[model samples]
Target: MTAKKELLGSLLFAWGANSYGQLGLGHKEDVLLPVRVTQGLASIGNIKCLVGGGGHSAIITDDRTIWTCGSNAFGQLGLPQHLGESTLPLPIKTLNGKAVEIAAGLRHALAVTAEKGLVFQWGVGMKSLANRGLQTLPVPAFMSAREPCEVPGFGHVKVKHVSAGAYHSACITDQGWLFVWGSNKYGQLLSSDDFLPLPFFIQPHHFEGEKITLVRSGWTHIVARTERGQVYTWGRADYGQLGRKIKSTQDSMCKSNVIQSRFTPEKVPELTGASQITCGSEHSLAAVGDSILSWGWNEHGMCGDGTEVNISEPRQISFFRNYIPAAIGTGAGHSMVLCRSAGQSGGDFKACPEEQAVCQGNPETATT
Candidate 1:
């Protein structure tokens, strides 16, 4: 019998603000164009996970090893405090086990191990009475070690997937239950402004029977998708990042009046059938069919909709209506998109649609 050989050919590229060299381009130079990242990680096997945060980047390879770069002021890179910052990807040590999944936020990082269903975290976003006097950890720490640790108000549960936000964290349990912790000032934790020192289960029968499949957090907002293809959002909506319009009834006397912000999870309209979702610091993107829909803050043209205005409702970007996006990543002030020709396989990559005539030839790559 002949053995089957696996082939993996994935490329990683990045752009936007490189003030911290988070793009891993070997320099802290910002580029308006996407450049292929090919340093330090050229020898790594297939990339299993690639995520970008405010000023740092992280990736997990098929070999189950974790690599990180950029700002480490709060040890978001999982390296020791004395190591300082890095412009190139470096392996993280002292992890209990091989990392299967990883997530990064503005000032914190989280990783899930393959064996024992363990989760580890580091950085300063997390707050608690025990560490009240301290600021932030310059090294990684255990959130749940060998055995499961019961959350203060919520019962004990094993986490299957997790996401770290700017000042909060979220996780989905093996039972499809969702829990959150950390700063809830903007109600990003789906409750009061009181900071939750421990994980708390979000109550609401709306997600009772649904199997939570995916959850992503922005700087101060969250986007969750279920097994049934339903999307829900909560937290800051000052820039319409929640994909809903604002309705104010109070008088203009309150100039600093708050707009619409969901203290609880609310379903976002027009994103019912999305398959994948990613969030920037204040913007979000979702993939449905062959098109990409984006909304929220776009002051830097991060929405990629050919406009600098903020989007309050989900709208498909006509440029990508024909080309299907394979993956998407976002950072504090930029967006990255990877695409492949829809309905075409192998080497059938072609030029973009005629409407976007500016791109007349088969481009070297597809990214924003």
Candidate 2:
């Protein structure tokens, strides 16, 4: 096979502040556009997935190996024991098997391997903690995290998906089980109706069985949409991110505001026929029947809508309604969406629908 086959495609990167060379654009300037990341990885091909942590970033391939660059201050790069910046792409040997998907927090990274279960993380973000130390790749302390610990769960169960947020992480198993961990500052870890005020620095059972088909983690909240298309959310909802209009309910998991804490999952009105969803740092967007609506934070026009610097509740972004987004990715301050124009054709490969979970990453890892 050609080398390109192994590398996926060309590397893609974008950085708002490149002072630490997080954008890998060869210079320490803020990159406003997505550019090629050629510092470390040269032989890789189509990038299966991309994740950002604080200022650093990581990309995984079909080969199962991971390449990371940018920030290492908190070891978000997933490289060896190092601080500073990578300046180039460095290989992560710890994750050898094919990684199906990955997500990033402010200072940590999470990955789900083809092996069966998900791997725990040891780095920064909401989970960062008193040990707020840094490492290049995962160290023994990281792998065996204690408080805000990486506490690898799922036992032997097969994890189907995983997502990371600013201070929290989330996942879904093959059987449709959902899990949450880290930062409870906003009750992001309490998945159930009865939640404690204390946030588990480690993974905790926020909610039980909801038959979730997909789950995505935001900077401070976690969203899971069930197979029947029912969306659930936990964590902070300062901007009505829970989808439900802020009301007088002051119960934990169901309550919001200082009057009552511990908000729970509530149905988002008008978010119907949603095939998929992704979350930005504080806001959220869902692809519903060829339309896109956003809520929560929109401070920098990240929502793609014309104005409204901040979206307190669910709002519509009509700009790209007609374009069908095949896939979507959200960053702390930015978002990436793959819009497959209708009538356009490519390699003999026909794109798969969202239900398949066909396998995330590079074409090398794609299954027929």
Candidate 3:
């Protein structure tokens, strides 16, 4: 009997801000169009996870190894600080064949190991002034670590997923419990305290009897999805990062006058049956049913509205109406979707319809 050949590697396409070569395209030029990343990931095996930070990116393969590229400033790429940066995907020997999930923040990164489920963190630590106006009262810095260090706690529980915001981090255990740490300047941790240097449980009561299955963080906000497909968000809302409207009296002078931030999690009424959720620096995206919805900061058209206006409410991205998103991701100023053609099958890749619309009749620029 002949053995079946194992399929190696998967196609990855990236676009948007590449000022630091975060797209792994072997160059530092911005990609206005989705381009396949083939420079350094040709033999890594099927990709398990992909994430991007402010100016860096990371990928996890089926072998459970990590490959990183782009800015390594502050050592966010899991490489030696001296290496500085790389435009090609380089294996992170420290986490070889151990990591199951990974997440990237603006200046830091986190990973969950497969064996003990221990969480590892690297890059710059979070810090914020207690009172910006009073330099003497400034909060102490959290101390940066260039190499991976096991995040204290979670020794007994097995973490299944991890997430990182610009300065905060979070993880969900196999038991469906959520723990968060780092900056709470905007109450992202659901605490009155300013900063949490160590991980702390979010309390089961806050979830209202429903276990959280997944969580994602923006620069200053968090969004979580329950086992029942219900979505909740909290933290900063001045930019409408929170999907729900802040409670306020009808007689309020104006929208700006009302307190927009939510210290605790609240249901996102506009989203239902969310299968996947991701957060950018100050924006969010979700795959619901067959469509994708986006909200929050849209200064760079990341919301897919083709406008630079900030989106205050969850709106369907018309550009993807004809496609069924299999997975969705967001960056500080960009968004990406991986989907198959509507009628095509058997692992065939389908280029974004918008890409086709823009490149049509231009043979040299066709994505497929």
Candidate 4:
């Protein structure tokens, strides 16, 4: 018998802010409703992964190729030329057979390969050899040392996951340990130093002996989840991105709720049993069973509560009721929710709203 592997669902949809064409809708406009983005991919097996950063979106084909769009301001798109941006999906040829998963930051991207667990990175501050003086590129170059380069200090261990924040990056090892490097401004890397020049293992006081199952970073914050779903958040919280609220001990008339930032990983008492978690510039999204919860900066409705209120408390998005979210993600000012119709055992999607605010590809090609 021929060999077979598990496949991911095919119902890819995007919505919310698209100022930089991060939605890949062929135009720079915000989408208030869900729009299909599975174009030109049915012929190439299943689309396994989707990732969003400050102003970019990416997808990985089941065949292990990468396609990206949106802002290439710092060569994050891995293109041969920095044409500002692309409103349509363009292939990143350099990562073809090399990446198993993609992680992105505000101005950078990381390709995680299982082979020796190598990580190839591009974008701002990625050229740093000693992790000190780094430069940013405004134009895209070929995917070589000038564009994409393998991380030197982390080739010894096998990384199973990778994540990128604004100026820093992180990865989880097969043994469930977390390693990070890059700018530690705001203490996002949990190090007192300014720049990490190289990847270093982080042993958070809160995670004394627990194994980390997943780790994600935002513009200036980082969150890690243990195998049992316990979550710890740290870093910039000026926008309440740490899922924490400040304490006010002033007199009754002078009391005010102050949002504070954290420099150490503190367990968020409200979150548990999260199967998946993702972070935006100042917001966060997590999945628990069929329910999805959000918190932090909601300036542009990235919280998806149909409101633009910055909150530190976790709130559930009722719109996803009765829907089984297969995957959830966040962008700088947007959110992407991929769900399969409830009651369907497979990755089959149900009918979505019919309205052509702006169209790309054949909508008829999406399966229900």
Evaluate model 4: give its lDDT. Answer: 0.68
Query: Candidates' lDDT values, in order?
Result: 0.63, 0.55, 0.69, 0.68
Sort by lDDT, best first: what order?
Answer: 3, 4, 1, 2
* TM-score preference between candidates 2 and 3, better one: 3
- After the best TM-score superposition of candidate 2, give how far the Cα of residue 9 lies from its true spot, in angstroms: 11
Comparing 1 with 4 on lDDT, the higher-scoring candidate is 4
lDDT of 1 by residue, 225-295 (tens): 66666788877887878897654455665434443436556788698866557777788877775577889
- Stretches off by above 4 angstroms in model 1 are 1-7, 33-35, 38-43, 127-156, 204-209, 247-261, 306-308, 317-323, 343-368
Report the lDDT tens digits of candidate 4 across residue range 190-254: 77677776788987456767777778889989988776567888888878888876544465444
The list of candidate 4 runs beyond 4 A from truth reads 1-10, 33-45, 125-146, 246-261, 348-368
* Residue 78 displacement (Å), model 4: 0.9
Model 1 error, position 320 (Å)? 4.5
lDDT of 2 by residue, 218-315 (tens): 77777776655656676677765666554554454532354233255655656654665767677677766556577776554556674546676666
Compute the lDDT of residue 70 as modeled in candidate 4.
86
Per-residue lDDT of candidate 3, residues 92-141 (tens digit): 88752388778888888888887788888888745432233224654323
Question: How do these models rank on TM-score, best leading?
Answer: 3, 4, 1, 2
Error of 1 at 135 (Å): 13
Structure candidate 3, residue pairs in collision: none
- Relative to the true structure, candidate 3 has a C-alpha RMSD (angstroms) of 8.2
Q: Worst 10-residue stretch by lDDT in candidate 2? A: 359-368
Report the CA-based lDDT of candidate 2 relative to the real structure.
0.55
Clashing pairs in 1: none
